[model samples]
Target: MKNKILVLGSLTLLSASLLVMNSCNSLPKGLKTIQDFDKNKYLGSWYEIARLDFVFEKNLNNTTAEYSLNEDGSIKVVNRGYNFIKNKYVASTGKVKFAGDSNEGKLKVSFFGPFYSGYNIIALDSDYKYALVAGESLKYLWLLSREKTMPNNIKETYLKTAKDLGYNTSELIWVKHN
Candidate 1:
């Protein structure tokens, strides 16, 4: 009687958790999973050229990301930036795990939540000169580079890739380097 009731309650909780997880992120038809990203080339510093303007990083500039391999085989994503509004540098650390096709350059990242979001690498330079990132939707896009700015051709190519991925490139805020 009591055990049966407890079992039923546990099952209900698990079912609810799964539903919540699925509802967290709305992915596109061919959205890449954790298995898509390349870990070796993915590591290093990537400058933020544009983004969808999350409130946390709003009014921020000189944004950069430093990634490293953690002890547990997870990638440590450390995003640092200088917020003009807050008048201070902010750092956000999050863990990233691979899903779907690891070699295909697609991954899902979570920032301390059960809900993992898309972090796909749609374009990258051979010399690692620049990288174009597309998040879960048409709004989440970023262009990064080793230097503060990139060449016109590279930038154009990246922008076109973002647009093809269903992002509105016009909204990309040109990051002002400090």
Candidate 2:
């Protein structure tokens, strides 16, 4: 009877996890992603100018992310950052694939196998030099650029865009670069 109960509990947990994963594909009301995104143009290195303080990347600086196309059509994601407190460089390699169609800018990225998080390109400059990325909810947001520091005008615009999307722009932690 104990074994049966354990099995039932495991199945229930698995179902809930699957449900959450599926729900990540849809953005909450009032949030939208860019249209006609070109993955090839976006492939390259990006510096994280600002971000929310998530556990995986808390207290990090000089953060950068590189993207390249894998032979199998998936995107290879390499993230590097300097942990000031640890006095070391931290890195994580992952894979990203479009959530629905490549043109939509909605992506699913996985650092740990089979477990993906949302990577929605909510905003992008016309030249593709800067971008704003969002995750499954308002708690996750990132401002990225080809350079370490973005212009004040651009930064204000992106912050405003995020604010309009229900994110708390004041909570953004600017990443320092050496």
| Most accurate candidate by lDDT | 2
Off by over 4 Å in 2: none
lDDT on C-alpha atoms for all candidate structures: 0.76, 0.91
TM-score of each: 0.80, 0.95
Candidate 2: the clashing residue pairs are none
For model 1, where is the 10-residue window of minimal lDDT? 28-37
Candidate 2 lDDT: 0.91
How far off is residue 26 in model 2, in Å? 2.2
| Tens-digit per-residue lDDT, 1-178, candidate 1 | 9999999999999999877654524455454433334687778988887777877678899999998999998788999999888799999888777644557656667776666777777777666668777776676778888888888999998787667666778888889897
Candidate with maximal TM-score: 2
Q: Candidate 1 local accuracy as lDDT?
A: 0.76
lDDT of 2 by residue, 5-53 (tens): 9999999999999778655586746878889999999999999999988
